[model samples]
Target: MISGPSENPELWAFLESLHRGEILCGTVTAIERFGVFVALDDGPDHPVFRGVGVITIPELSWQRIETAFDVVQVGQHVSAEFLQFDTWNLEARLSLRATQPDPFQAFADRTAAGQELHGRVTKLVPFGVFVQVTDGIEGLVHLRELTSTSVEKPSAVVQAGDEVTVVGTEIDRERRRLILSRRQGPTAH
Candidate 1:
């Protein structure tokens, strides 16, 4: 039912049949700083783009990533949901995280308050440092927890990429807040 030979028959037909929430698989053709590009197996080549499907940073994974390469690599095969059709670019907007299970449930099931865990410092804020205990779960290590000595800034005690051991002081599932402490001498750089 597509109009002309100049138009991609396979792509036109596939787009007509595509709908939100449909799951699709493709090879990661490219990985840019902003997003990941995928060439779908069941679709035709994009008329103007290198790949027909795109997964933005937030859609790449549930975990916080410093870059697109952190979650996927070129030639990696991924299955994702068809979030929408990008009419402007004539591409498919995809979400890779939608296909994966939530990692928080597993973290909560195994960990409890007072449990000491080792994680890498991901970010430093005015009040505290954010640490990634697992892939997607981050806990806040408040300024008071940075060290025994009174500190004016989190940078004085720790920096991003530093490894530190912390004790879970509080875990509020409803608030999704995890408070950690260094009361036991947060060592293990």
Candidate 2:
């Protein structure tokens, strides 16, 4: 039974009863390729323990994640489902299968001034890296744009969800309809 508001037994009871299930609609505290950290609702003002689940390279975005650098990042807010609950440790297993439009889809549908995305580094190659924007879209940050069009190596500027801005560049490839982009702007050198 729930003791009092101080105890927040409703949450305790839910965890105890859910057994090997989830408690959806939570906030993401941290993100990694494997999975994400979530804090559920109806709990104390403190952050609850949510374990990491891998999105794998391919699992990133609607297409395939070529680089870990292409997907989600830390400090960004995300909606996820509670896939599993660990009673012993009070940790929750989360899933990106929580919101509609999924973030990735929304990004793809964007044609506005600019966008702010928080992604994780799926991979870091010479050219640049891939960033999974949401759950179904990945954007490329080429070498030049790594820092103000003067960059030769993408790695020198950003690692992953360094949370960079992707401005719409003129269509470079008609075949693929490629969008040329550079990091936000103003390189140190």
Candidate 3:
């Protein structure tokens, strides 16, 4: 179990003062492949790190990025949402994406099952191909839905960067999932 500020009064007091989901403004102090460090405005100084806050790769942005440098740079000002207090690291976990609109939610709002969508195949796995339906939104085209006939692998049907037309078979908003099909005809209602 994670302990609160009472465990270490001085180092954790700044994080204790913050609440989850609270918006915070900070400057990007360091950008690593794994995450970014932020020195929060009006926050206490840290003895070990340049900042008292950290934002992991997944929390940096909603879009799939190759590196932390792609989304942020050192000394850049950023507004992030407080996620949690990291007792081990003695820093507050933050999320830069939380401050931005969720692309998946926006896509789900305007899209419906059976809708036709044009996208580029982003990745191929043993089970399916991931298609980028829109910026920051990728949907899975399961192997079974790749075609009417049986296939051994997704690579046989499509390659990365291949532009394809797919029909949305299911839109699971709660799961943030979109199931797509490329079965050569209108999707059955």
Top model number, lDDT: 3
TM-score: model 3 vs. ground truth: 0.90
TM-score, model 2 to reference: 0.35
lDDT, candidate 2, 1-189, per-residue tens = 213324655555555554333435545565555555555544433333452222233333444444544556655455544456554444544445443334443544563334444555555679877655445445666677556556666667777556655554432232323232555522222
How does candidate 1 score on lDDT?
A: 0.84
Error of 2 at 176 (Å): 7.4
Which candidate, 2 or 3, would have the higher lDDT against the true structure?
3
lDDT of 3: 0.87
- Candidate 1 local lDDT, 17-120, one digit each (tens): 78999999999998888898999988888776678899999899877788998889999999999998765566789999989876766687789898989899
What tens digits encode model 3's per-residue C-alpha lDDT throughout 92-166?
Answer: 899999999888899999998889999999999999999999988899999998978889998888899999999
lDDT of each: 0.84, 0.49, 0.87
lDDT of 2: 0.49
Candidate with the larger lDDT of 1 and 2: 1
* Sort by TM-score, top down from the best: 3, 1, 2
